[model samples]
Target: MNDAPLLEVRHLTRHFDDVAAVEDVSFQIKPGEIWGFIGPNGAGKTTTMRICATLDLPTKGDVLVNGISVLANPDNARGKIGFMPDALGTYADTTIEEYLDFFARACGLRGDMLAKRIQSVAEFTELGHLMGRMMDSLSKGMSQRLCLAKTLLHDPQLLILDEPASGLDPRARVDFRELIRALANQGKAVLISSHILSELSETCDGVIVIEKGRLVREGKVESLASNVSKNELLNLRCLAKTSDVEIALAEHPGVLKVRESEGSFVIEFDGDEKDIADLLKTLVNKNLSPVEFHWHRIDLEELFLSFTEGTLS
Candidate 1:
């Protein structure tokens, strides 16, 4: 989509009395990108999100939404962002349609425009069926969908979601992940914070890790995984005996260990791509007749644990 970043945070810092809530944190989110903001409780994830949403001003830094500075032009920056907080304070008596209509009107939409925007977000979020339902009576998943619909009413270019998947069930989490991917595909930049590292690893293009109100690491999920991973899991399926393959792999230069499970050989390899290629060549020379060989790389959880001490606050 666009070459320029849709959201940019430059050395953002926030302090309350003597406590530094956030310190010199900086990151950028380009259009059609989903960046995961990850950390434990009280790690300043919410504070950073508030700054980007223009709800709270940074003490020392600046945030730009579509090149509009949050410090210099907060109203303009707010217009470019749709912020969904951890707790969506909804009126219990309001129906889904009315809720969306109210937000659309508040965003300066009216008449045909309000109606069209409500209908569009309703259809997109699949909230049309629940239009007549009261907010208090809806399920957790349905309420989250409604909140997302409210966030989309103004058609903002950037979405800052704080713990969006927090109380969602397994099925609801999957559906929400798909919905987020769809939004990014439509050229919207999404910066989402969540404690679910495994899910974020699957959906986000990259992640930023913060601890003790300071940035610790920020990069693509895959690249970080590769860099921090010390070993690789490779599964091999061969026509020969499993024990024979295991012994052969154990003696290889790059292989750390080998085990047999079911009808395949599981190998722990400590090597790079070229090493893997050489391994395959060695296997071919040994006439192992491998039917399947696949490498299972490290995941986000491992990468995150490598950097953090695994403690909240």
Candidate 2:
């Protein structure tokens, strides 16, 4: 793959009347890379992505898909991008096969090329078995798969997936993540948005965080993890029962704060590797009998909340 960016958002701004939904946001996605577009609701993520997908016009700046200007030449840019939106338009009385065929023709595909693309995406999304089923009768998971299959019909180099993993079950989410990785391996660049930070953490190479219509941060996942959060997030669970885990953790001078979860305690520790090991031993000696003790350098949720004030524009 080329080192150049397949998708570039340069100083993009979008407004409706007097309110700016997006303000001076910019990011780049290189071929075979996955960049997560993340922000809370009303954070202009959808607006920014819409501009890149040629679904909305930018009030300022430009977006380039495969170096083609979407602002000036959307018709040509459309050929280079595949956009999977949050909702698939209701095609009443349309079968899965019929819906895909409609889009295949709309994409200017015909004859053997059209048939090949339809079958290819169907197989890729595992929609081949449900090809005869009505679109309206499909479950949320299947609908998401269908949305992706529609997006892939054009074989675009750049893919914009808006909340692609939202509402999906665990298995469906896992399959979607693998699908995204496979697409990137085939030399496609993806800009995906979702509220599920954990899923994005596992799949995205980097992220673009937008808040209140402004660009806040954009960098590699690990780079952001190290720079944005300095403290360690530890999850501690006991095999017997939830003990005075907080009191046991307090024995370690490295622990900063503690919060309770389902059956585990989330500890905020400003400790080194040795401090962590010492904390484990300290808990064991205290009769906490920990069954699971895990620690991670980053929490995308905390990183998100720390940067944004939950303000809506």
Candidate 3:
């Protein structure tokens, strides 16, 4: 990836009359990186994405796609960015191949170039076999892949995906993640917005979280996890019941929070090298030694929930 930013949104604000849809959001996306633009519904994610995609004019502030100003030259900006909205439409009579061909022609591809682009995108999205399939006949997952294929027809440098995996199953979601990683590896700067924290952690390089129409946090996933839960607790499986284990660790100073999980107990603490040993010694004294113990890492869902203070829709 180059040192220069592929896309930059500076003080981008959008408002509907007196209501601020997006409030002075600023972020930079580097080449070959998948940046997760995340937030709950009505958090201004779609509004912000539309501005970046040149589909909506910002009430204030500016956006630059590959250094081209979106406001000053929207046509140029459109050429550099591909937008996949949450809802997509497909013509009932058109086949998958015909749909891609239509978009390619609209994007000004000609002759062999159009054919190659259509074929390439079809192959990339695993839609080669569905080329002749009518749009209405395709399943939800297949249609979503077709939507992505259509988005790639123009071969834009930056892609803005808004909840692209909404209706996809687990297997289809995995395929979608691989598709996104492939795009990033091919040096495309992608901005994906999704409420699914697990999906974002699996695909994105960094995350930008918005809340109440404002950017609340932005950084590496590991940074968020480390900041929220440091020296995470170990899940201890005790032979005793939950009530007995809770009583045994109640007075232990090394333990911070104790909660029951399934049939086991989860003990959290700021355990130093000696604190871990002390915790085990304390447990042994009560004749309630744990049969299994495993360290836990805080996931993106936990980190996001901790910071956002609510469910992401």
Model 2's number of clashes is 0
Q: Residues 1-313, candidate 3, lDDT per residue (tens digit)?
A: 4768889999999999988999999999998999998888799999999999888999889998888999999998898888999977959899888888889999999999999999999999989987999899988899888889989998989999999999899999999999999998899999999988888898989999998889988998888766765545777888877777888788887777776769776667776868887888777788886888777666777678877884321
Which candidate do you rate higher for TM-score, 2 or 3? 3
- Shift of residue 150 alpha carbon in model 3, Å: 0.9
Summarize candidate 1's per-residue lDDT along 1-313 as a digit string, tens digits.
6689999999999998898999999999999999999998999999999989988888899998999999999988888899999987959788887888888989999899999999999999898888998888988898898889999999999999999998999999999999999999999999999877998988999999998899988999877766664587787888877777777787899887676669877677878889999998888888888889998655677567768963211
TM-score of every model?
A: 0.81, 0.84, 0.92
| Global lDDT scores for all candidate models | 0.88, 0.88, 0.86
Tell me the spans in candidate 1 whose CA falls farther than 4 Å from its real position: 230-296, 310-313
Stretches of model 2 off by over 4 angstroms after superposition: 231-296, 309-313
The local lDDT score (0 to 100) that residue 36 gets in candidate 3 is: 91
Model 3 misplaced stretches (Cα beyond 4 Å): 237-241, 259-266, 310-313
Model with the higher lDDT, candidate 1 or 3: 1
Residue-level lDDT for 300 in candidate 2: 74
**TM-score: model 2 vs. ground truth:** 0.84
Error of 2 at 4 (Å): 0.3
Find the 10 residues in a row with the least total lDDT in model 1: 304-313
